[model samples]
Target chain A: MDRNIARLRNRLDGLGVSLRPHLKTAKSVEVARCVMNSPEGPAMVSTLKEAEQFAAAGVRDIIYAVGITPAKLARVAQLLEGGVDLAVILDTVEQARAVAEVSRQTGVRIPALIEIDCDGHRSGVRPTNQVQLVEIGQALAAGAELRGVLTHAGDSYRGGGAEALQHCAEVERLAVVDAARILQHAGLPCPVVSVGSTPTAHHATDLMGVTEVRAGVFVFFDLVMAGIGVCQVDDIALSVLATVIGHQREKGWIVTDGGWMALSRDRGTSKQTVDQGYGLVCDVNGTPYPDIIVADANQEHGILAARAGSNARLPDLAVGDRVRLLPNHACATAAQHGSYNVVRGSSHVVEAHWTRFGGW
Target chain B: MDRNIARLRNRLDGLGVSLRPHLKTAKSVEVARCVMNSPEGPAMVSTLKEAEQFAAAGVRDIIYAVGITPAKLARVAQLLEGGVDLAVILDTVEQARAVAEVSRQTGVRIPALIEIDCDGHRSGVRPTNQVQLVEIGQALAAGAELRGVLTHAGDSYRGGGAEALQHCAEVERLAVVDAARILQHAGLPCPVVSVGSTPTAHHATDLMGVTEVRAGVFVFFDLVMAGIGVCQVDDIALSVLATVIGHQREKGWIVTDGGWMALSRDRGTSKQTVDQGYGLVCDVNGTPYPDIIVADANQEHGILAARAGSNARLPDLAVGDRVRLLPNHACATAAQHGSYNVVRGSSHVVEAHWTRFGGW
Candidate 1:
């Protein structure tokens, strides 16, 4: 985790942009402290629960990155009144109006960013849709602070190799930069220009107009990121420990207690060149078993088998033998458990237990 | 939940078999009390955590339905010593030996059921494999109590309509009964016979030699169950409440705060005749919108869109408007949440909060 944090931190520092590590993946204050620029962070979060939790942990500069709803404004106000510089993101005039109204009503100037669509992957206004972008910025400037513009290169996960990732990073940069430029030309405060996704954050060759980069999953890379060439399989920092409970020897199946409930249902690698099934199987010492994967999963049973057409012999895993399964998507899989049984390096010895929280 | 519970209970009662409702779905004690045959429970659980929690809540007759491992026997022994009749299931002689060892060590005659594979879906010994079946039973009877046999029609989820489900039910019953006969022929005691799957439990025409039925998801029917003709969409008792936060009008997308984090990534209905995307979107009153579904999901954002090729108009839902999303798999979706906001049919008011526990 420290190596991953350092890799991104070094890259962004060289690009002259600050890092606002997204805390949604590792919802642990201990982990947050390691990745943040300081103990009191300028971090990003997907849910208000994260924002509130981090705020209590002394993270003052936090942005709730998911699109905001009017009903949630009260909670945002409470955070702001508590002296946290909590900001929100929105793409619609309706949402901007709601933020402004809440800011006025609470007598707390709520800071917000206009979410820009980088590649039409998910939410946000298109960079070329200047009218709506300016309207939203103007509405926020009326009462709330129009702090900046933000965009995520969510489509970057679809492609592999450095060239494709660099292109995605460029598109991400241009989208938020263009929106920030438009807001500036319209005499609106667009002080912060943010963009990222784990792939883009690692592969970007430039961040000239961006003020900060945001990413979460890099803290614990998984098979999806490895599939997209952002990291190697060995670079993945998270895995679910499972015990062999039974076997279907004729069918080459070694069943384990780790199932979809333990490893999430995120088949993020199904479309990749190599599908890792539910996850890649590994020895307890964190060494991958060649071509072995969780072929299928029930609620509490994972069927481990050799990958199709692979001659990889099924390891002689007996009942009570322990194995680790690397997750397809770290964020989704990590959300399944309450705490991380942290182990340093490849040691099997006990280490500190880091608690992770979940909820909207 | 009450109505769905009663539906399954009445069906099982007519078949003269007891209902040992699986508590893995609703991990809430309140919901378990509603679904169990009695407060003391003849219930089935997928994880040891559920067995321990329910046992702490006074559920004595519990079965850990997942195949047992030697490492987990200590906990089973602990439960047994605590006066809870915690039975276990296993298909291998190795597991049987471990159970026997634990029973001998702890001075608790651990009861175990030999798992019989009704269909080649997942775990369990094939009923036709008499040699293996008797071997496992003999191994259990040597030190542990050989209770009977159990089988689940896991493949029933693949087929829709009554005839297919009834066939699955009969196959499940025959598989367990055949295994019990094999044990009896070998002069081994076979007192209990268990068979089920939600569809099989509901559609079984005859329970002939079966002693008990086990089904979990039926307590809160989901879209998958409805698609398979085991229940209707209106009968689904669980949903994720979401707030409309934004829109991409040109794309016909209504964005909500509920994502895979809230709804879960279980696309169980995708293989069915009518694929409900992430979920079926309903109004606050619980009436589903015409052809509307959550088409895509990010970590914390659900994109609500009309079903492909449907001429249904997108409802003008504004920011802060609430909607309920019926899940594709009740067990998977409910596992994502910490508690259920109990409400009466079609009412928006939350009457109580029923906490659900998770972990292995």
Candidate 2:
């Protein structure tokens, strides 16, 4: 955990950019503390529920990264009133006006960031859609301060290698930075230019115009990250501890107590070169078990077999034996459990339990 | 909820089999009360945690359907000693001996069910493996009571149609009943003969030898069940309420706050006749929006789009507009939420709030 935090922090520092590590993955206060370079530094959260938890934990600066809805404004007011330096995102003029109206009604200055779509992957206003961008900026400026613009290069996940990742990183940087320039040209206070996704953040060649980068999955890299070449298989910090309960010897299946309920139903690696079935199985101490994959999962049972179509001899594991399964996506898997059974260093003993906050 | 309960109860009553409704779906005490045919009737649970919750709700007869491990015997003893008529399943002689040892040590008469693998879908000993089955029965009878055998037609999920489902159901019934016969012939008490899986239980032609039918996911039918022709789409009782947060108009994507976190990472319909993406999109009144689906999902954002490769028009949904998404698998989707914001009849008004217990 410490190494991952340091790796990202040092990289961003060298690039002369701030690290606003996304808190969505590790929703624990302890993890947030480790993620932030300083004790009381800014961090980004994906939900208001996270904003509430992180704010209460004394980490004041927060960015509710998802586009805000009017119904959530009242909750935003509570956070602001509690002295939380909260910033919200919005792309539509309707959302901007609503945020502004809520800010006006509550007499609280809600900081807003214009969400720019770098890639046609998910939600955001196109960076080049200057008319809509300026309109949104103007509307938000009425009752909310225009913090800047931000874009997540979601397509970066589809990238094959470091070359693709670097290209995506550049695209994300250019789009957010260009949006900031347009807003600045319109006389809007464009202070922050944020762009990230684990792939892009780790591979970006430059961050000259970009003020800060935001990423969540880099904290506990998973198979998806490994498949994308952002991290190696050894860097994955989270894994589901499971117990072998049964076997289908003919089919070479080892049934484990850990299923989708323990590991998540995120088939993130399915699109990659290696379609890790459910997850990659490992020994209790986190050593990768050769030729084993959690091929399928029921509500309470995981079918561990040789990765699809492989004729690898099934290990002679018996019932009551323990193993671990590394997740395809750390964010999704971490959300399954209420807390992290933390293990530091090479020890198998749980060092401390870190509580993770969930829900909206 | 009452209608779903009645539907299953009526079906089981005519089949002359008891209903051991699996509480893994609606883990609520309130739902369990409604689901139980009698106030103190038997129920099935996937985890010891659910067994603990249901037992505390005054539902006496509970079966922990998963194969038991030595580690869980202590918790099982607690449930049994607390006057909960708890029964556990085991396929191996090792597990049976462990249960017997625990029962003997605690002076708690643990009831045991031998799991028969009728279909090679998941865990259980084959019914034809008479030597092992008899050994397990003998081991359990030493310090525990052999309550009979149970089998889940897990492969019924992979069956093609009604013909296939009926065949799988028959396979489940015969394997469990044959196991019981073998045990009875071996001079071991074989009483309860359990067989089910939502697909199998609903399609079974003969329940003559079966004592009880255990099925979850039937109460809240999903797209997978609908695709298999087990239930109509209207039979689906659970849906995710989501709010339109933004849109990528050019791509025809309507972004919402319902993400994989709200909808779950269960892409269960991917292999169905109609791959419903993440889920089939619906209006607030539970009306299906033609051709629309939650095409993709991030942690807190669902990308609402036309089903893959379909040039369906993006609906004119603005920010804050509400919609509902019918899940691919109710069991997997329902696990994502902390509680059910239950609505009764045709009204949009929340009639009740039921809490669901999650975790192992």
Candidate 3:
């Protein structure tokens, strides 16, 4: 995790862009501190629950990346009044009006950002929707600050190779920058131009017009990231420690206690070249057990089987063998547990325990 | 939830079988209390944490349905010593011997059940493995009590219609009963014979040879159950309430705030006749929105799109329109949230908030 943080920080530093690491993956105060070690500290949060947690941990600046709804504005106002520089993102005029009304009613200054659609993946307005962007900007009434624009190339996860990632990152950067330019030309304050996705942030060649880059999963790279050519399987930092409870000898299956409940149901690597079923099984020391993969899972049991065509002699695993599992997606897997049992040394000794919060 | 509980209880009463409702669905004391309202107040738990929770809630007779691991035996012993009649399941002699060792060392009698494989879906020894079953039964040493057998026809989730479900229920019944008969023939005390799956329990014509039936996901029936011909869509008790935040008008998509994080990524209905993508979209009143389905989902955004051939005009969904989503799998979806904002009557008035626990 420390190495991953350093790699991203050093890369962003060289590119003259601030790293606003998304805490949605870790959701821990200690992790946020490590990621935001720079002089200008800020972070991106996906939910209001995350903003509350980071705010309590003394993170002054937080961008709630989800598009805001009126029902949740009072909670945002409460956070704003509590001395946190919390900003929200929106793409529609109705949302902008709601934010303005909430701020006006509460007498709290709410910082806002226009979410620009980069790769047509999830939420955000198209960069070319100048009229709608200007209208949304104009709708930011009293006690509201039109901060800038942000975009996430969420579709970057679909393709493979560094070239595809680079192209996606460029699209993300240009879209947000163009949106910021449009807002600025319309006499709106466009200071922070943010863009990211773990894949894009890792492979982008340049960030000329972007001021801040946000990425989450790189801190604990998973099978999906490795499948996309971002990092190798060895680079995955997070894994679930489980115990082999039984075996289906005839079927050549080793049953483990780590099911979908422990490993998560995120099959992010299903579309990749090597479709890792649930996860790749490994030894306690984090060494990959070749050919063994969690082929199927129940609520509390995982069936570990050898990959097809790899009919090499299977290990003689007993009833109480302990094994580790590498996840398909770091964000989903991390959210399954309340805390992480950190192991710092080569001996796989229990070091410090870090707690993470979830749910909204 | 109360209605669903009553319906199941009445059905099981007529069949003369004890219903040991699996509390894995709604891991709440309140829901458990409602489910255990009958004279036979015992409940089945998936995790030790649940056993602890139910024990604290005064549920004396509890069964930890998952296979036992030696590492968790001490905790089981602790619960046993606390006056809870906690029984655990295992299919291997190694596990049985470990349990026997722990029981002998701690001097706290641990009741054990042999998990019989009725279907080739997950854990358990096949019913035909009589020698192995007898060996496992005999492996129970000084402080261990062999308490019969249990089986879950987990593959009942596959294919639709009442005929398939009835066949699955019969298989589950006969397999567990046959395992018990073998154990009894070997001079082992085979008192209880348990078998079930939500679909099987609902469609089973007879439970004559079975002492108890264990079924989860029936309390909050989902699309999977509906697809399997066990329950209708209206029988689904749990639904995620979300707000329509944006739209891709040209693509006929209504973007919602309820994403895979909120609605879960369990695509259990993908193999069904009707492939409801992420979930079936409904209005706030719990009425199904005609031809609308969650076509795609991100971490925190659900794309509500019209079905392929359905050219019906979608109702104008404003930015703040609230909608409800019926999940693909109740167990997986319900695990995503900490609590359920329960509503009663057709008016959908939220009468109470019931908390549900998660994590192993």
Q: In candidate 2, which residue ranges exceed 4 Å CA deviation?
A: B309-311
Using all chains and alpha carbons, the TM-scores for the candidates as numbered come to 0.99, 0.98, 0.97
For each candidate, the alpha-carbon lDDT, in order, equals 0.92, 0.89, 0.87
Q: Determine the iRMS, in angstroms, of model 1.
A: 0.9
Model 1: per-residue Cα lDDT over A1-360, one tens digit each: 889999989988888889999999989998999999999998999999999999999999999999999888999999999999999999999899999998999899999999999998889999899999999999998899999999999999897689989999999999999999998998888999999899999989989899999999999999999988888888899999999988989899998999999998888888888899999999998899999999999999999999988989999989889999999999999888888888888888768898989887
DockQ of 2: 0.77
Fnat score for model 3: 0.51
* lDDT tens readout by residue for model 2, A114-214: 99999888889898899999999999999888999999999999867889889999999899888888899999899989888988989998888998899
True contacts kept of each: 0.74, 0.68, 0.51
Shift of residue A182 alpha carbon in model 1, Å? 0.8
**Comparing candidate 1 with candidate 3, which one achieves the higher lDDT?**
1
Candidate 1 lDDT: 0.92
Q: What is the interface RMSD of each candidate, in Å?
A: 0.9, 1.0, 1.1
Q: Model 3, range A176-228, lDDT digits (tens) per residue?
A: 88998888898888899999888898888899999999999999999999998
Model 1 alpha-carbon miss at residue A349, Å: 1.4
Across all candidates, the chain A TM-score values are: 0.99, 0.98, 0.97
lDDT of 1 by residue, B1-360 (tens): 889988988988899999998999999999999988789998999999999999999999998999999988999999999999999999899999999988888889999999888898889999999999999988998789999999999999997689988999999999999999999999999999999899999999999999999999999999999998889999999999999988888889989999999988898888899999999999988899989999999889999998998978888899889999999999989988889899998887899999999898
- Which residue pairs clash within candidate 2? none
Off by over 4 Å in 1: none
Residue clash pairs of candidate 1: none
